[model samples]
Target: MIMTKPRIAIAGASGFIGIYAIEELSKNFRIRALCRNLPTTNSLNSDVQWFSCDLFNLKEAEIAFQDCDYILYLIHSMTKGSRLTQSTFDDLDLIIADNVRRSALKNNIKHIIYLGGIIPEINYGISRHLKSRNEVEIVLTCSGIPLTCIRAGIIIGSGGSSFQIVYRLVKTLKIMTTPKWTKSLSQPVDVNDVIQFIKLCVGNKEVYNKVIDIHGTELISYNELIIKIATLMKLKRTLITLPFFNLGLSKLWLYIITGIDYYTISPLIDSLKYDLKANHSLYFNNYIPNPISLNDSLQRAIENEEKNEIKPRRKTFEENKVRTVQRLNLPMGWDSIRLGKEYINWLPKVFFTIIRSKVNNNIVRFTFLKINLLTFEFSDDRSSTDRQLFYIKGGLLVIKKDYPPARFEFRISPHEQSAIAAIHDYYPSLPWPIYRIFQASFHKMVMYLFNKHLIKIQNKKV
Candidate 1:
């Protein structure tokens, strides 16, 4: 009994989950990747084909899904803007769903598999990210296509946005001032299991027109998840929940601390107010025989992250020539000499002047001051760096050359107060003034001589 591989088309094939899904399904399926960017790796099996097509464009989407048996819709627009509003999220969902439905109908695609959020309720406290997921599910269900929607909670994986945030926060913080939503329950699933579920849904007649809730074996609170992560990393953490902490304010705080965009964090924090625990009774009765444990999933995720760290990161032409001077000890009052022209008097004064520069061209033209701290030393070859350390801890970006890295320990200072005023004057839209000030302080200026320079520093050895 010889079985032939099904021809499957994956939209948003370049995304985190999409890439993982491709890796899992590529061996058993003839894949057609529909993405905005062309596939970078030539290592894809010969059975895979790529089409550079924007999913928002209905015409292009139609062409992309042509002759495909199954269509996987795994796209979202959280990173496109500063705020993920409910209206904006809904609009994107409607647009994607309509376009996908039309394309599927035109191409006679047999089935459509959509990955969406598990949260049923939506509110101001709920993140725009989760609301968007809910909207996408509605659109797919209403569409004429036989849609299989897999509603999943936080997916715990190495490179996933949610997991990355938790991993970094847990690894870095010792005393955590978390919000009330830390007690909210969520059932996170493994990335591997998510891919498996998607693969199983492909052309499965029994599950073709069903909405399944998928999750890991454990139902734990955000605080518990943090504790588990800290335990895994062998770090001691003391958790303190602030009763009056504003959710939106907390998101802004997290953005400053984690270097994760506020737009993404806003929605994630909103979703934490509700219980995202998945009811796996249906899944157990219908889908697989068993699901993986949270411990095992976390272990795999860490391994994957370690592997990713060692993997060679590909950079653009502009990124390659950009030199990163590690822990360069710049003396106080260090002046910039650019092509024999003196740009500024000293490092601190120059930084202050750079912040005051109101001109847009002036902002992006010269080299910006960039500061980062080496936080976790995994090995002699590998170490973790946090770019937003100063900002997160309410420390101002001080102007000093030859400042030792050890002097920049996470703390709050009076200079942080002055930094806020400077940041607000320059970048008004930045939510937390104090945080932005810290970010701007440890700045790196790339001289115009290397305008198109791109540099990648590899700390991990394969």
Candidate 2:
């Protein structure tokens, strides 16, 4: 009798490690790509089957994991903007692990492999990202499925999120003054080596039910990593470390300078204060006799990035236009506030009047309010022509047409009705009382309605 190839499902298959894992495993195992978004069939091998399901949803996860022998859980929320804090990491990790484990149990998956971070001892206060990874591993271990957790240091590959941060910073800055943490130790691994270890774990029962640490041989400081990258790119760089700099502040500065965003860089910078060195004896004993070196790994990543051979095909606005529109069109309730005697009146009719949908998901809502005589501005000696016209959705409100063009633009969350208000009221001169009162009451009400309505929509979908 001939043995058949084992079927495998890879959640987060669209990510850095997951994509490479699929490529590496496709030749051997029957591969199933499980992700929130449908995998673009354009680049994937025809043998792989693509399934779309949100990992957090139990029913959706069940359908995605059905009939698979092995699962690769590589999902994380680093791409979710500013909200990717420690709490978000914990919530998302718990939810995803619970759903995936339950589904794995039902489908009788033989093994689960997770890719996680390797932190330094000094910085062991669970960062949102690290805590989340640790929590998921805990959930997986107790799930009854044999599990292999590969905790790795900073992945040094082009196109990977961590690498992109270091890459862009080194490329953009000529002289860098950074926090003291820049001198912290890290063992950066090549993406390909990480992928190779993941692939090797497929049928290796000895490695099952184990947490393995993987890293390149060299342990270098982050500043050294930057210098190496600068040397590779042939860019001149000078570095100075300030004693009192905060990671949070540094993250904001990096985001502004490099365009990588604060949420993505914060956890990385925070974790950098510790030594991330790992014991490689176990890896050598179980896996390849000689793993790829740091230089070889870096070279390969640079070459691949140059060749544009990475997965997920960085989406252009034209490609995402439809999805963007769909998200905008998703129904969200509206609230209108009309200027009043003592305070503004919060009512639906006032908020939704004269709403205009502009190009590229921009929306504007206009409302005209009658000036109340008892209002402070009306009590002033000025003539009674006082009327307030509020322009919202992009956070533009014109109390006076003669006011200069909007200095800042804002967008309302698709499922939330509240437009950020104080930006307009503070310009020219600050109106502290007016701004404070309107913002607190109106903003709170809008968020309340928006969340209430969003919950209803999600429940209805179920």
Please report the candidate that would top TM-score against the real structure. Answer: 2
Displacement of the residue 421 alpha carbon in candidate 1, Å = 39
Assess the local accuracy of residue 42 in candidate 1 as a C-alpha lDDT between 0 and 100: 62
**Candidate 2 clashing pairs?**
86-128, 336-350, 336-351
lDDT score of residue 166 within candidate 2: 74
Q: Model 2, range 48-121, lDDT digits (tens) per residue? A: 88787767445578788887889988887554411111123445455567668778888889999988887445
- Candidate 1 wrongly placed segments (more than 4 Å): 1-4, 81-87, 121-127, 310-462
* Model 2 regions lying over 4 Å from their true place: 81-87, 122-124, 309-462
Using lDDT as the measure, which candidate wins? 2
- In terms of lDDT, model 2 sits at 0.61
lDDT of 1 by residue, 409-438 (tens): 111111111000001001212334443344
Worst 10 residues of 1 by lDDT: 416-425
- lDDT of all the models against the reference? 0.59, 0.61
